[model samples]
Target: MEIIILIAVGMLASLCGAIAGLGGGFIMVPILALMYVIPVSDISGTSMAVLFVSAISSTIAYAGQKRIDYRSGLTFAVAMIPGSILGAWTTGVIENRVFFVSLGIFLVLMAISINFKPKKSRDGFLKPNVSRSLLDASGQRHEYSFNMTFAAVVAFFVGFLSSLFGIGGGSVMVPTMILFLAFPPHIATATSMFSILLSAFVGTVSHAVLGHVMWDKFIWLAIGALAGGQIGARVASKIPAIAVVRVLSVCLLIAAVRLMFKG
Candidate 1:
C-alpha cells in the first residue's frame, strides 16, 4: 500500500512537473516531508531521483515533438552546473527549518510574479542583441532574441535553487525564459525540461554521495515518473501557451501556501 502511494505521488508529480516545467520537486518534496514523514534531509535527494527520471522521459517526448530548443537549453545548462554543485554541497549545512521556510518564501514570490500581470516578449517592450530561429514538430516557426547576460545570470540562480530544493527550477526557468529571453512558451517548457536533466543528474549524484538518497523508494518513483512524463509531454504539445503559464502559477501558489504551513 505504501509502495502504491509512492508511485501515485510520482505520477502526480511527473504529470504536473512536465506540464509546468517545475520538475515536480515543488510538489514532491513538501508531500514527502509533511505527509510521509520523510526526513527533510532525504527529501531533496529522493526528489532529485524522481526528477531525473521524469526529465529524461519528458525530454525524449519533447525532442520527438521538436519542441526542445537544444542550443539555448545547453547554454543555460552549462552555466547552471557550478551552482548545482554548490547547492548540493550546502544541503548538509542548512537547517531543515531554514530550508523549508526559505523555499516557501521563494515559491510565494514566484507565484505572485508569474501570476500577476505576466510578462512576455510579445508585448514588444524591449529587444536584445541576440536573435534565434527554430522550427517545431508541427513546422511552426519561432524567432526571438534576448540578452545573453541576463539569461546566464538567471540560469545560475535556477541551478542553485534546483539543487537546493530538488526541483527542476522550471518555476524559475519557464518564467524567466519567456519574460526575459523572449522564448515562446512551448519552447521554454520543452527546453526547461531538457536542461533540467543535466542539473538534476548532478544533484542526484551529489546527494547520493552524501548519503541523502532514499534508495528503497527510488525505483518506484522513477517508474511512475517515466510513465507520467510521457503523458505530460503529449498534453503540453496540445495546450495553449497561456494555459501553461496559468496552471504553473496556480501550482506555485498552492505549493507555497502549503509549504509555509508545513514548515
Candidate 2:
C-alpha cells in the first residue's frame, strides 16, 4: 500500500514536472520530507533518482512534439556537469535540518521569479546575441536569441542547485530561457527538460556513489513518472503558456510553505 501510494504521488508529481520542466524533484522532495517517509539527508538523492528517469521520459515525449531546442540544450547540459558533481559533494556534508529550510527558501524565491513580470534584460557578459528559429510539429514558429557565453554560466549554477536541492533546476532554467534568452514559454519548458536530463543523470550518479539514494522507494517513483511524462506532453500542448507558469508559481509557494514549517 505504501508503494502504491508513492507511485500515485510520483505520477502527479511528474505531471507537474513535464508541464513545467521541473523534473518532478521539486514536487517529490517536499512531499517526502513532509511525510517523513525517508531521512531528510536521503531525500534529495532519492528525488534525483526519480528526476533522472522522468527527464528521459519527458524528453522523449517532448521530442515527438518537436518542442525541444536540442543544440542549445545539449550545450548547457554539458556545462552543468562540473557544478553537479561539486554540489553532490557539498550535499554529503550539510545538516538535514538546514537542508530542508534552505530548500524551502529556494522554492519561495522560485515562486517570486516565475510570477514576477518579465523585463527586457540588458547587455552584459551574459547577453544573448545569437538568434534562433524553429518550427514545431504544431505549425507554430518560434524565434528567439541566446548566447552560449551567458547560458553556460547559468547552466553551471543550475546544475549545482539540481544536486543541492534535488529540484532538478527546472524552476530556474525555464525562467532563464524565457526571460533572458527570449524563448517562448513552451519551447523554454521543453528545452529545460532536455537539459535537466543530463544534469539529473550526473547528480543521481554522484548521490548514488555517496549512498544517498533509496532504491526501494525510488523504483516505484520512476515507474509512475514514465507514464506521467507521456500524458503531460500532450496536456501541455492544449494549455496556454501563461497558465502553466502561473500554476508552477502557485505550486511552488504552497510547497515552500509546507517545507518551511518542517524540521
Candidate 3:
C-alpha cells in the first residue's frame, strides 16, 4: 500500500514535471518527506535518483518526436557533469534545513520572474538568429561556440546546485538560456533536459555511494513517472502558452511556500 501510494505520487509529480520541463525533484522531495517520513537529509539524493529515471524516460519520448537538440544538449551536458560531482561533495557539509530554505526562496523568485508581465512586446514568439550563449545566475559566461572551458565552469556550478537542491537545474538553466543566451523556451527546455540527464545520473551515483538512496521506493516511482511523463508531454503540446505559464506560476508559488514552511 505504501509503495503503491508512492508510485501514484511519483506519476502525478512526473506528469507536472514533464509538462513544465522541470526535473520533478521539487515535488518528489516534499511529497516523500511528508508522506513517507523520509529524512530531509536524504531528499536531495533520492530526488536525484528519481530525476535520473524521469530524464531518461522523457528524453527517449522526446527523441522519438525529434524534439531534442543534440548539439545544444551535448555542449551543455559536457559542462554540467563535473559540477554535479562537486555539488555532491558539498552536500555532505551543508545543513538540510538551510538548503531547503534557500530552495524555497529561489523557487518563489523564479515564479515571480516567470509570471512577470513583459513590457517589451505582446509577441509571444522569440526571434530567430538568437545566440545560444548563456550567462548563469552567477553571471558566468557559457558561450555557444562550444566553449568547453566556459561550459565546464558553468556546468560545474549548475551541477553542484542540482545535487544540492535536487532540482534538474532547469529552473536556473532555462532562464539563463532564454534571458542571456536568447534561446527560445522550447529549445531551452529540450537542451536543459539533456544536460540534466547527465547531472542527475552522476548525482544519483554519488547518493547511492553515500547510502542516501532508497532503491525500493525509487524504482516504483520511476515506473510511474515514465508513464506520466509521456502523457504530460502530449498535453503540454496542446495547451495554450498563457495557460501553461499561469499554471507553472501557481505551482511554483505553492511549492515555494511549502518548502519555506517545511523547515
lDDT (CA) for every model shown? 0.81, 0.80, 0.68
Q: Flag the better candidate by lDDT, 2 or 3.
A: 2
lDDT by residue (1-263, candidate 1, tens digit) is 87898898899899999988878887788778765666565888889878999999999999999988888889889888887888788775767566667777887776666654445344312447667788998999988877777787788888888887786688788877876677887898899999899878888888899888898888888888998899999998889878987887887776777667666
Give the alpha carbon lDDT tens digit for every residue of 9-102 in model 3.
7788777777666777767777787876665547778778888888877766656545455766786777788777777767758776776688
Query: What is the per-residue lDDT of model 2 for residues 99-162, given as tens digits with 9 covering 90 to 100?
Result: 6677678778867765664534322234567777889998998776777788888999989988
Candidate with best TM-score: 1
Candidate whose lDDT is highest: 1
Give the 10-residue window scoring lowest on summed lDDT in candidate 2.
117-126
lDDT of 3 at 57: 72
- Model 1 bad stretches (over 4 Å): 115-127
